[model samples]
Target: MPPGPERFVGRERELRELRADIDTPSLDALRGRPAATCRVLLVAGRPGSGRTALALRLAREQAARYPEGLLYAALTDPQGEPRAAREVAAQLLRGLGREADDDPEAALREALRERRVLLVLDDAASGEQVAPLLPHGETALVVATSRGPLAGVADVRPCTLGGLQSAACVELLAQAIGSTRVTCDPRAAETLAERCGGSPAALRLMAGWLADRPGMSVTDAVRVLPDDDATPLERAFGVVAAQLPGPAARLMRMLVLAPGALVDAHLASALAGCALEAARDALEDFARYGLLRRDPGPGAGTEPAAYRVAGWAVPLLRDALEAGERAEEVRLARARMLERTVRLVRACAASAAAPDEAATDEVPLALRFADREAASGWLRRRLPELLGAARIAVADGELDTLARRLASAAVLALDAHGQAAPERYELHGLLLEVAERRGPDRERAAALINLGDLDAAAGRTKDAVARYRAALDAARAGRDAFTLGRALEALGDSHLELGDRERAADWYGRALAQRGERGELADAARLHTRLALLHTDDGRRDAALREWRAAAAAYRRLRDHAGYAATLAEVALAQEVSGAAEESLRTGQEALRWARQADDARLQRVVLLGMARVLERLGDTEGARLQREAADGLAGPGDARDS
Candidate 1:
């Protein structure tokens, strides 16, 4: 047996079928057809469903019967360069040690007649390409696999493989991530199984990836895994290129050029340049043909779901889109795709914190209430397509408007989702190009601010500061005070991350002054609080207290109770640091009330600890003891903080 780690799991029924096909009928008359009658077996299954695996496994198991050897050949005919049956036969003959140059059909028949061989013709384009490869006599057993039913082969036992069972999927995960890890967390295992769609190839790929990253948890892996629909989606769309009739196929190719994953019936209608019903009919036809997967529309009764090209066919759809003669149609398709992607990004970026009912105000009506996970999923899966579209738009040069929109959309997607963000290279590269190409200084500044903030979150402090500086300059040049204030604050945060307390204080102070003049109360208050922390670090206790007091009043006026409470905690800290024992004790107690009311346990604990230290310094030993007890209670379970 092979190593258990690599051994096949699931498919006991399929294995039994293959075994029954191979076994000769017993001498008993009731046993029916003998294995000799099963000379040709066609194993049919969908792409990536393990047909190839079954064929190889069955061939290996029966190797003893065919002592000569086995031959395998691929028969799919790629477009504009179709692989012919003659070529396949000639190749199989050569694998059997015969000259391929000899008359292909004669060589195949002569070679098979000479010995006991097992032949596997994989991915046959159609039944006709497979007929010539069939054995003429019982000297050999032949197996062929295809996406669809392969007719014309008489008496061939067909074994079609479906996805693995859920249990088998779990077993595959255990093999991939090790049994101990999976068994430790059964839920993660099940989630992984469900997400893999029970496809052995996908399971094996995921497992191999997990096995290499020993410390990565199964749960974390599941969280990061792309939706099951992605690959199959590409495959389904690929067939649009191969299987659709002329104009419909052209429409599909155009659809693939779409920027984001989705293309609504209206826009798809426009791109296909057909009437609404005709376009809708084409989309439905594509769905019926499995060329695209439908995204359930909102409250539309699910009868008229929005559709996008499926995942697996993405590449094929792409090739077709790029290959067709309608250059103008392709260009327009690219423009539309960019336009939609930009719209999504703008909506997400602008309204990330919006209440659900109002979130769609800035977004497309179809996209409102679309789960963040699904939106982010589409963006991540089609990231390459998104980036490619942007680059193409840029290269077209004349479509600078489309390029700007694409660049901004890419930036927005990145802004809203961090690790799950679309590709970084495209977001930044395209933004830089668009910024240089256009004179919209404020727009350029806004894009830079987003890029800088993203860099700061990603821990690229220096790069983040550089972006912030450029944004600040652009904002100043555009006389945009709002953008300038935001940029300065971001720059301050970046410097704070680098531990440059003085420069961080200077930046925040400038931001605060500008925000104050403009009544940017919320921002100005936050900046004041940040500046106070630096003052305390430098031992300017009075200055720190004054700044915190000013910030607290600002937050209070703005009705930001949480912000006011946070400022109080900071004030309590500065007082203790400055040795104002009595004042610190009073301030901490007042801060505790606000923190607790805020319902933030983390903040409450910080205030409790501050009170304990303040009482200790004020020589109130018993009072300090009580505060320590309260702090410990708020701290909850082990304070190790070590994951």
Candidate 2:
């Protein structure tokens, strides 16, 4: 496996005794290969009896004996559906960094023929699923976990995992809540663990409940967790659900319908149409009963709030929601949550805008952020939940408008922060689908350009050109000059990458014309720099110089001191690259002065270093030495280059 829990509680004696059945000595481990299998240690038990947990612990304990690698595969998907044997085999093969399109199982067996590897097949639905997965090598070990004995399989050594020891159960509780609470009354703690039937899951649920109520005694738990001679594993979840407060109990029902695994106080609040504190209290109640696990999310590090639906609790919550909640109630809850998500996503994007742009974007005072940095952090932190919400909205028939709005806001925020290319590619595709189906032709054009940029970044120049072409159509239909410029610029870049220099130049000229009409000085300056780079890299020295002058003129007119300084540094680098030492020195000096005025440390360092190189080339050794000292004093941890 992927390493099991860092802290394993209980089952010490079980692990010690099971080693006799599972562990093989060094000499005996190298015996001739079996006809079809190696030693199979099947750990079997009831679902909530800690079967998988015990198997994980046992398999991990043998790490030294099988150092080749530990390959694990869950025979069942997360939805409790059985996975095909071949699929599981393919996953195992991939884990070993080997693959066979024709036959993964055979390829896997060959790969592990003489290797001492640990193969963990978890949650085997039947003997048929387990049979095909077994390695036919004597040196390999198969540690399979199942809810019951694997029928029709012979000569398999078995280990039965069950309830925790009473002492271990108490220790588990103490670990979850605290020793002080358990130590306050050891007798009551023992009773509480005993009442939980020593079932680890039950003990954990009971522990979470007590942890929520610090003042409540373990005796109170012993009483509340009922002991009617029925198995706690079978009854604890329902009993806890029944015992929660009315709103919390209802919230528990609604939680089952959540689109994603994660939930925050804000999402929970909207789901129930309740106050934030009320939703938080409900989440606390659900978490206390193990219906939801406290997972690290957006709030975990920054806000101290978040929970994920516990996998085991899904079916139970679904049953409860079916029995107690109405369809309309669930629908309205989803609507409330979706609308809230749209508003929040829009505000998050707006929060990162400059004051001039933000004036036109009015957000609620409660949702607005102080500045771009804060908004960027919020976007990074909440991106997962936002994605989840977007998925739900896109799928909901009644939420198309909200979904389209969310897609627009989220895509821009992701672009602003320079998030992952793959993720942006996926989200941009979704935005395109939503925008096309939902109206607003301009957004469709924007989405096409956004996705085209991703495709270009991944070296899919032809695909990017295709998208840019489609974007040109959409932009023309919508009369959006800004998006039109973007499409034209992307086409130019893609064509350049494909070595169609003449076509690239034509697109660049068209894009510059569009940018001029659009009246975005920043855009014009950026385009000038792009053309400068293309000319410089193509050895068109005079054309590159003209483009750099245009970029500088645009930056100066815009009063962008930092932009002007950065542009001059680029010019200095270009001059040095073309062997104009005197021009490079003069340009570097101008760059340093502007950088000082803009207080741009990064640009200052770049210019200083550029000047140092020019001085060295001119044989002015002392001047170069002084420039080197100045550059060294401005050095930072990761400022390796101008970028």
Candidate 3:
């Protein structure tokens, strides 16, 4: 679950009642019920009334009961528009590791059926929008926060929220500025809370108004604080907006236009076209004014504070400075930021020790890192925002070139990390959409292949094969041999995983033909190894030996000792299984030599054990014993995995 706001007060009774409701026995545990309606709890409130914060806090508190883990989905985009049910369900399916980007409602239901996951659907628009997305099981809990009533969204308990208690509101104010100011004038604090209508958001703005003007007392602020036909939140907003410094106000307006969940000093600088330090100062001002919340995560500080645009202040920012007034400035700023992201992503990808051809391009010196570890850390740290930026680019459909570049680079940087499954699904899905819409043929082919690779990793072999086949068509349309070969190789891998060795062999053969025509030693080694494995599985002795020898020769040409050793080890095993003990022993000895040269102790130990078996078969019992002893001595305590 997402972190709730700091200094949350009140809502205690509502929480208790809702907790009881969630724990209460559901009337619809069995399937074929009216969807997930009974399993849901809708928390409804007006804007700035703490609806989202309350829902998040409750979700976190109740997380442990739902062993399947908690899922948080913001039903609205950053712009506050209600996203389509299809889009929301697709993201939910992706988050659940079920990749169905198009028409994902049924898949989402299938994913949530019988799963005890807690789903927090935040900022829902109405009943019609939320109705289609409820979970299908009583064991699963759905906590939906909405500004609207969501009248028929669910047949569950409803928690209607209002302003905080006056005392709670005063305590909230005291927490922000010091207790001394409120305690210094008790009557005025009560009046201030009442005047702000006990809304946390408005009170926070008032606190900022007073905090920024330290010399002014609570009484003085109250004297000038507008009390008009406008809502208290709006009146408080009027005071803050009227007093904001030029830079801070400008930064706030552009920030709503800034894509993603964060706005750092560098991003602020880009958006405002100001110096970094100046942007930092303005961000500090925004934080103090409660226009942005200081992120409580790691690396929190003034020089590099990551501020989340306060959800309540979004409309205020738009009202203060409409996006249309300075549309070009926002566009240029976003473009500049996107360009920087492309270079940064490329540089990180290039940091891999054996970078492939596409990711080896030169970038700005500043973007380059000292080592692979540092590059990986940099890339992973910024991956979320980088991906968010790509989504925005696609939604906006303007920065096609930069968005496509970011697609490949982002996937490259993330593909190696197994824990990045969610991001991989999201990025590839977005890339596939973008590529199909307007991207060049090469990008389209690459996107399909990458998505297919993800599906293959997830054990969706049939789906992967479908995507790989599409990628082949795209690659052929572009006449790009590299992507075509890649598609063939991926298809081979998926078929192999599916236990269709014949089809796998065919795909590998096609891929090898292309690789030999256009690529290098590495591709040859890989294809030969794949073919050798397939042949070995089929018990084709001569064919397996020929492919293994070819693989070893390719590896030797490339001077890859590790690959050569592994291939030789395979050859020894095949010989041993085929009753050629003496030849097997010789091959194992050669493999052990190359394994030692490669400094791969595990590979060496494996060869030693295989040689031991060969020695025993040859009636050399003492030699077998010695080889076993050597292999055992090389094994670490934790290295008990099957060789």
Which stretches of model 1 miss by more than 4 angstroms?
1-268, 275-376, 406-419, 422-425, 559-562, 586-618, 625-643
How high a TM-score does candidate 1 get? Answer: 0.50
Model 3, position 395: C-alpha lDDT score: 78
Model 1 lDDT per residue over 1-643, tens place = 1101234677789878877875443233235543332266777777657676677777777788888877776565322123577766755664554544435766787667757888877777677777777766566877777777767755667788878898888887886567999888889878776776676655654565466468878787676675645663243233234545676766776776554445666456546665556767777665544345455332111124566554334556666666774777677766665665566555545444546544454455644435555555445433544665687678777678878776766665656755333246346667667767874898788778877876786677899999899999999999989899999888788888998988888888888889989998888787787778788778888998999999998988997767778888888888788777788777877777877777776677777777877777777789877876777766757552211
lDDT by residue (tens digit), candidate 2, 372-478: 77666666645645765776777776677777767767787776655542345657777888888876889899889888887887778899999999999999999
Query: Model 3, range 1-643, lDDT digits (tens) per residue?
Result: 5567767888898999898887666555444344444378989888788888888888888878888878877777667888778777866765665555445777787778888888889888877777788766566888888875777754667899988998888888788888999899878988988888878788888988898777878898788787888898889988887777777767777787666557777667777788877888888877766677665332211233467787778787777766334667667777776766666666666676465543444654444566667666555445556778888777778887777777767877665432353567778888888888987888789888888887887778899999999999999999988899889998888888888889889999999888888757799789998898888878898899989999999999899999999999999998898888899989999999999999998888899989988998999999989998889888978776334
Error at 162, model 3, angstroms:
2.4
Q: Of the candidates numbered 1 and 2, which has the greater lDDT value?
A: 2
What lDDT score belongs to each candidate, Candidate 1 first? Answer: 0.67, 0.75, 0.78
Q: Ten consecutive residues with minimal summed lDDT in candidate 2?
A: 294-303
Candidate 3: stretches off by over 4 Å: 1-43, 52-76, 81-144, 148-157, 164-197, 214-230, 299-304, 336-384, 412-418, 429-441, 473-480, 497-502, 532-643
- Of the two candidates 2 and 3, the one with more favorable lDDT, higher being better, is 3
**lDDT score for residue 412 of model 3:** 75
lDDT of 1 at 330: 70
Colliding pairs, model 3? none
Query: How do these models rank on lDDT, best leading?
Result: 3, 2, 1
Model 2 TM-score, all chains together: 0.58
